[model samples]
Target: MSVWDDLVGQGPVVEQLSSAAEGTSGLAHAWLFTGPPGSGRVTAARSFAAALQCEETPRGCGHCASCHQVLQGTHADVAVVRPQGLSFGVGEARELVLSSASRPTGGRWQIVLFEEAERATERAANALLKAIEEPAPQTIWLLCTPSPEDLLVTIRSRCRQVMLRTPPTAAISEFLVQRDGVDRETAEVVARASQGHISRARSLATDAEEWRRRGAVVEIPRRLTGVASAVVAAEKLYQAVKAEAKARTTELDEAETSELRHALGENAKGRMPRGTVGALKDLEKRQKSRATRSERDAFDRRLLDLASYYRDVLRLQLGAGNDLFNVDLEPELRTAARNGRPEDTVRRLNAIMQCRERVAANVHPQIAFESLTLALRTG
Candidate 1:
């Protein structure tokens, strides 16, 4: 796809990035691209970098050698750091900065783009700050995070920030249909379900299992009819979450465990340094926290999926007509709409929000989710 095509509903962002790529105002070196999860921050940054690297006679001609390489993330001068673990550690930041120090081989700029800088630890951010302050003449730094508040004030102040807004649903829908050759119906559902997140929209559209999982989540509100149902739902939900947590935690635990082993091989006979042991424990704690967060996020996405279904029910109750996003739930939605009042719909929305809040406040997922089922049952 072309550079601008991936930007979806973000006209303002596309225009600004296109202008910068066209060499307007001489292109700032340190740019901070921030937006909601689905906003095209990383996509925009890559597009801008591609345009800059393009050796096309017109430059930024998306089809040119330089542009293609940069877009494919193979450009020698472009370094993108995405987190493997939960946070970008100081070690990773140091490596990026070291790479950023080298000059571009082409006559253009050496670029480093941090895709999720909010994930960077404070010490890592400091290391990034040093590189930004003393950037090589031809080197440019692009830091992308969710918000200005995510980065340190010093880092935020130094960089030129470009904020991306939520793309309109129609824009996203039209984009998917036009560029991806996806049917209009599927595109519409994916776009609406994605809630302005392009990556998630793409996944929802292309992945069959994701759609199936969403269907499972939407069906939960109906099936939670009694105490036994609640308990069973709670058990199932806990197992789902626990399954995910175990998968994520295992990989992370293994990697850290390996790192620890490598750092202190079996050859060591003396006791480990107190500081080293402390550092290892801290890493373990952080890993566990991250695994917990990952599982929670997965659970939240499912809740949001269910919320979308209730919203559809509300839509039907309001006589909003047929093109509901959840095709499988048309029957239940129609039934709920006919039997439920507007107040009932509102109450359901509140229930969903409360469940979200409870989850965020560290209430056990099973309890919060089961309680949500009860509220939703009445509504």
Candidate 2:
């Protein structure tokens, strides 16, 4: 299939990118792809990069060497910069700028795809801005972010903007069934629960553990019966989240340590080099920072899931007649709506959102969760 096939419910974006790949009127030296989470901004950018490098008659013929190479991230002329930590630093951006200044080795346009451009530090943005302002004749840059306002005005000004919309639930369901071989029932459940987040839908559809965790999250509202129960629930949630984050980080941490040790020429019998100790310490520090960010992101997602359950409850209470994201939990949602006042649901939603803000502001997750649980109990 074509690289564009994976981009669900973005037909207009596909058409624009495809036409540009074919040397149509909308072609530009730089492009900014903006969309909400899971809108496939990065996927669209990669597909466009592949199409640009494709040598086939229609362009982006999936079987062509250029197309395959770009899609597989093996193309010499293509570079993808993804920040593993919370933010992209000036050092990394400068290196990318230098790399993008070089001519393409494959006799086509050299493409640089930067994901999460919103995370670029001020210095990093400045570095990127310089490159975009005076790009190499054979170079192209594609930056992906949640929105245009998240990027520097200067950077946004120099690039052609491409906006992507959330994929419909039906489209997500179909893609899961066709591409991932998921059962239709499970696919639909995950798609609706994801609320247009393709990645979350895939995870929920394929991972039993994720489904179980979400089940627990949706039950939180019903479980907050008193202050003691709320505290216990908050503790449980925090511990579970931390455990999951640790499980995800452990293997990556070990691999990174091994790689760093090897790079420092630390073998089984060799003594440590003079500066290797400091280098290893720095690497560990960075790894810790990345792990913290990962844990925060995981916790934030759990908060969002919690909020969605209450949102469904709120919708039911207000007779909004909107489709519920957590359809499987509708009975519980209706029970809560009937038992609690509409104002209570709104307060709980506000509490969850405030917890998210507190966590983002570096408050202890345990404290934030505990506060949120109590708010739910008393709201």
Candidate 3:
């Protein structure tokens, strides 16, 4: 029912954050909040920022105008920057530094939130460090990343770190029932299935399209019977993942490219500039890198889904319980696990990880994924 409740079952994190809200630790100007995706890193940052800005007693009055604006992203003091295409380059970092250096208009703290600080390039990280080292008197810098290893040690050394843990299934299920109005049966199922990924739990509780997509992916392992089938599955994954990556990055890339092209004027379009060729090549390189990262991220999500299906199969093979992600596909799980060994399940998981490593290393995605499908199909 409140912003804090949106974060699944992080009672310990909530308690620590609440203490921080009450002016504990002298209110350090910099904080790094790190966790897995869907673990409410940004959500925690926003709530903490709102609590910082609230004038009401005990802070974080969700009903206050300040909290309203802060939550809605219209507040003057709190600024959140989610990287557009891929990397947060020096230009973006400089803008963030400038915003943080300015006086807060609302007479509270100026909070700059970096969502996915792991995506910041080395140059951008240095730019951010300069601002953090000698910050504005009233400014607060909050960085959210998947892990501290993703950030420069120099930058992290200056900030207080808040580590987030995935909540237990019981707490997660209770959270959904009390705060989201979800029924107990559905809530418990989603809680267990999501493995404490709060946002994913919520989506699984409500979304049908997601189930269909995951269903298609889980079914592919069993359907790979021939070279043609394997190739088609590989292409299906590539096209699906590539389309998603393109959908996310294309508009942003075009806008940035247009801006650069416009700034150079009509003479620079086809005519020679001393550095034009190099810049073009550099741009292409970064774009390709970003595309690969996005595709891998998407594929990883699917792999996790496949792993979950296998997990359910493991439980079923042991007669643990009736828990199933694809309630409609339970018979399929029964059929598949019926023949698969515990070692076979392990081999499949390892194959998925090996495929991920290949993709991360910039292997040709089509070949890598195709090999993965074939290996898991018959290995």
Candidate 4:
């Protein structure tokens, strides 16, 4: 296996990065990786970093010690920056620039892989732009964002861009079966359900609770019989998604707090020094922002699932031959199509999109979801 093995359906990108790693043409000091969510932007960057540091011939030999270190995020020369809160600020960017300016410890390139680069505040981005503009002889920057427009025009113009596409359902399904040993039928179902999101498909294939959560979401349309049911459904969905998000983040938050307390001279009884309270409070504030973002993102996934259900109904109503995203709910979708007009399905979809936008804008989730469910019921 090579470093690019895990990057499903990104053959052209793999080729381009491999050639650069081999000291061929298309090499650049700064690279921008842009792709939709779950398109493996960070994965591609990390793989390229590994290849650049690999000790074996052909650059990306997966078994080499350097390749392993980079892939596992233990390489001294590679720094992976993942923003923990809603925004990355100027202070953190300054620290990053300082770290990235250092020469490589292992005689290879000093690599900085910045994931979610779009989350950088304007000041932070300006700091990053300066870093990219001024080159360290051994430094390379890998920036990952959803779109080139997410970064400053100067930064975009400075970097070589690698665009990743959503992998085909067949590729994801085969990968699940071959790599994870999932049953073929189950793999196919999750593959189609994920809508070309490789990580999501893997989770759906392996995580029983995730499959169950999706089931609950797709069933919401059928339960929207009246205003009361709609309100109740909305509340339930909101609570479930919130709980999932909290579950995902609680452990990380606890670990971070514990580490900070120890760094602040906490004793066996967990008491800290004077003036440490302020630092703890700041960490708490950042953790809260991260939790809020996680909840919003989780709820948005549920909304997309709801949208898929309505889209399936619309497809059936219009006699479109396209495959349904909710394949297991085809019968229920057919019933929905028979009972509703295509126009109504379109209106419900619009409402779901509106709710997603409102939630992203920081509207209270319960209020947004409630409004959405009422619209869906009426439609």
Candidate 5:
């Protein structure tokens, strides 16, 4: 297998990056990779970085020492920066810029990969822009985000753009079965349900808990029969998202706290050192920000799941030929389509989208989900 093997359904992107890794003239010092969520932008960027360091003839033979080191994140010349909170601040951007000024130690290039460049603050973007504008001869920058428009115009203009498409459902299904050992039926179900999100498909295919959560989300329409039930369902959804976020972050949060205390010598005396209180406060603030973002992300995923279910209902009502995303819930979907007017389904979808916008605008999840469920109920 080559480094490109894991980049599912991105043949054109693989070809372009491979040629560049082979010393093509079109290669630039900075590159911006844009794609939808779970479209593997980060994976593609990492693969390209590994290929640049590969010592093998085809440039990305995954068996080579350099490739292994790069993939494992132990390469001296390669660095990856991923934001832990809601945004990447100027301090972190400056640190990365300072690091990028160094020349390559072992590989042909010194590479810096930034995941989610869209989350960079204005000052952070300016800091990155300076680095990109005056990069070292051997330095290369790879930034990943959902779209070029999410970045500042100045920063994006200085970088070569690489666009990635969402992989087809069939491609995702095949990848899940072949790579993850997921059975074909489950693979197909997950592929359609995930709407081309590769990571989500893998989770739904491999994890029963994920499937149950999704089932709960999609079944909301059936449960929202009265005001009391809608409120109850809304509260349950909010709690579910909070619980998911806590489960995901609890271990990492504790580890980070322990590391900070050890670094500050708190473990030696069971008390914080002088001036360490401020540092601890900063850490807690960042963790809280990260927790909030994680909960919102979980809630968004639930909203998307709910949207896809209604979309299936709409398609069934219209007699559309496209495959339903909620194929496993066909009986429930058929009942929904039979009972609800097509106009009502459209209203329900609009309400769901509006709820997403509201949540993004900092509205409380309970209020947003309550309104959404009530709209779904009335529809």
Candidate 6:
């Protein structure tokens, strides 16, 4: 086994990283990893970090202690920077530069794996550019973003780019069955439904709630028979998306709050010492920001699922005959296709995309979904 095992359907990426790990060529102080969501961009960066710090031959040997530590995020010389809120500010970037400039305690590379580099603020990006421009001898920076255009051109130019493709449905299905012990049929269903998103495929196969949520989303098209039904559907969809987002972040938010309270000398009854209000407020602000981002992401996924239903209808209308994402809902899709024009399907898809843009611009979720549902109903 090797650290690259978790990276599905990325043989070329594995070859490039492995060769670099072996010090043959293509090694650089800064590396940029770009790909679509669930395409394993961060996973590739982490695996490369492990390979660079491997303790055995054929670097990234999964059995080695260094590899294990790196994979588990406990390695002394490797730091993982993940933005907790919507934006990573300049203060964090400056601190990261200072921290990463130090020599490695393990006598190897001082590696910083930065996830969602696109979320860095303008000033933060400038700070990062300076660090990348004159990195220390043993320092290596690995940045992950959805696309090269997300980052400043100068920063990207200085970094060697490693582009990862979305894993194929067959590869995702095989991985689910072999690694997660999912049944072949269920794996196949989720693999196609996920549309090349490996993480979503695994979640759908393993999590009953995730599968149910997706089912509800894909069924929205069928429920929009009238204005009243559309309005009700919009409210329900908004509530469900909000609940999922809250469920995902509530545990971590509570844990961080409790940890911070304890660190600030909170008594057993949970009363904190004096002058701790500011810090608690800051933590609360960050948590709120994180929750907002989570809710937006959940809504985006639901929108995409809705779009896939219309996509299948469009394909049927056009005689495309391609594989459908919602294979289980074939009858519903066929009915929708038979009843609606391809132009209507296209219009509904545009409405969903517009709703997504509105939400990203901080529009109220209820307003966005209500608008989207009405458009779908009319279309």
Q: Which consecutive 10 residues in model 6 have the weakest lDDT in total?
A: 320-329
Q: Per-residue lDDT of 238-266 in model 2, one digit per residue for the tens?
A: 99999989888989999998888888898
Instruction: Encode model 5's per-residue lDDT on 296-332: one tens digit a residue.
Output: 8998999999999999999989999279998999998
Compare candidates 5 and 6 on lDDT and give the better one: 6
Listed per candidate, the RMSD to the true structure in angstroms reads 4.7, 1.3, 4.4, 1.3, 1.4, 1.0
Error of 4 at 86 (Å): 0.6
Clashing pairs in 3: none
lDDT of 3 by residue, 1-379 (tens): 3446566657777777777877874688899998877778888998888888887767776888888888899898889888744578898788888878999897488899888888899999999998898899999988999899999999999999988877777777887888789999888877876766787778777887665666677788777888889889989987877776778678867886666666655274555446566776776677776766677777777777767777777777777646665555678888877888877777777888888788777788888888988887776
Give the range of the ten consecutive residues with the poorest summed lDDT in model 1. Answer: 265-274
Q: Model 2 — TM-score against the truth?
A: 0.97
Off by over 4 Å in 3: 175-180, 244-294, 314-331
lDDT of 3: 0.79
TM-score to true structure, per model: 0.79, 0.97, 0.82, 0.97, 0.97, 0.98
Report the error of model 1 at residue 273, Å: 23
Clashing residue pairs for model 5:
none
For model 1, the local distance difference test gives 0.80
The residue-by-residue lDDT of candidate 6 on 1-379, one tens digit each, is 8999999999999999999999997689999999999999999999999999998998899888899999999999999999988999999999999999999998379999999999999999999998999999999999999999999999999999999999988999999999999999999889989988898999999999999999999988878899999999999999999999999999999999999999999998979899999999999999999998899899999998888888889999999846888888888888888888999989999999999999999999899999999999999
Clash count for candidate 2 is 0
Model 6 quality (TM-score): 0.98
The C-alpha stretches of model 1 lying farther than 4 A from their native spots are 241-294, 314-331, 337-364, 374-379
How far is 60's C-alpha from truth in model 6 (Å)?
1.1
- Each prediction's Cα lDDT score? 0.80, 0.92, 0.79, 0.92, 0.92, 0.94
